[model samples]
Target: MKAEFFTDAKPLTVSKENFGLERGPLAHVLVNAMLVSDTAKGGSLQYQVGYQLVYKPDSPGKKLPALITTPDMSSFCRLFLERGKHYLLGGMLDQNGGARVDLCSLAIPWKNVTGKQHRELLSYRCD
Candidate 1:
């Protein structure tokens, strides 16, 4: 017996809002980070992260060397995004078009993703 196809089936279309890019530029990539330094000032914590880009964007010379500030220290601690670890970061671009990963950005450990998933993410259009 042969299986029947459902002609009425429709493909699901995901909206850009689902990716949380409705308000800003989205830059997603894998990175290895090293903590350069961190400081607390006026109840806010700032971290200087030295990161190496694992995925280069379509436009050359667009990737920045570091992440200057992560607004909330508690959130940063919760994620445990420490130095010497690789993370898949989904960040927004600043006024200068440099990617900034902070409390609001999505940061996941690189070890958890599969190779296929990594390839798909790398091919995604950030612009």
Candidate 2:
């Protein structure tokens, strides 16, 4: 697996942490993903395409779901976060001990995920 740092993703308007005495506010997270292929073919190729996204939000009493799409761009999902949701939010450390959110690869795609609709994201990550 390969990865790169992305700084151009969109994010929601909210604070960082949920409840806190420390860094209780959240920032934004941008994820840029790419796929490469060695063998070129029709409907396929020397795969080299990418996406420029915005960011993710993790504010108090506020949670938003990711609109996850597949590599083939076939599937689409939009999950929403609700209050009293439990999930992990990771990021960098600020000078004021605040949070400068980093792009996390792992997180419960849905906080209190409702239906069996977004299980694809979990499978996508396994690829």
Candidate 3:
């Protein structure tokens, strides 16, 4: 059997002008996520995550479902991400219109997240 390794990838840059609508909220957000499932196949990994918008720079919280993908096999162990744990995640919509979280993204255990980090994430400005 081949051992899998984790890899880090840069996040996609999101501009205020094109994230969504001029009047809509920015696409970047901080979320509290519960890992529902994780599957690996064909050189890709997919996570079925249920998340609540913990903080958005300009909007109220909301609950939603997302499918996060990563081409790196090591991302699972690298982030210590696992099923049934609540995690603090920094996420954005990918080009395919699905929410994504990866090595370069901010993903940590909820208990490990600091208040300052939360505040900073909540106050981020897309502009």
- Residues forming the 10-long window of minimal summed lDDT in candidate 3: 1-10
Which wins on TM-score, candidate 1 or candidate 2? Answer: 1
lDDT of 2 by residue, 1-127 (tens): 1121222223333456522212222222233332332323312111111222212322323332222222221222212222333333333322333233222322243334445523432243311
Please state every model's RMSD to the true fold in angstroms. Answer: 12.5, 16.1, 10.1
| Whole-model alpha-carbon lDDT for candidate 3 | 0.46
**lDDT value, residue 115 of candidate 1:** 95
Candidate 2 backbone overlaps, count = 12
Q: What lDDT does each candidate get? A: 0.43, 0.27, 0.46
Candidate 3 on 1-127: residue-level lDDT in tens? 1111111222445577535312112222233343433344345445665544444433344433355655445745323366666666654454444554456555667767688966775786556
> In angstroms, how far off is 118's CA in candidate 1?
1.4
Q: How many residue pairs clash in each candidate?
A: 0, 12, 1
TM-score-wise, the better of 1 and 3 is: 1
Off by over 4 Å in 2: 1-81, 102-106, 109-127
TM-score of each: 0.49, 0.20, 0.48
Model 1 TM-score, 2 decimals: 0.49
Better of 2 and 3 by lDDT: 3
Candidate 3 similarity to native, TM-score: 0.48
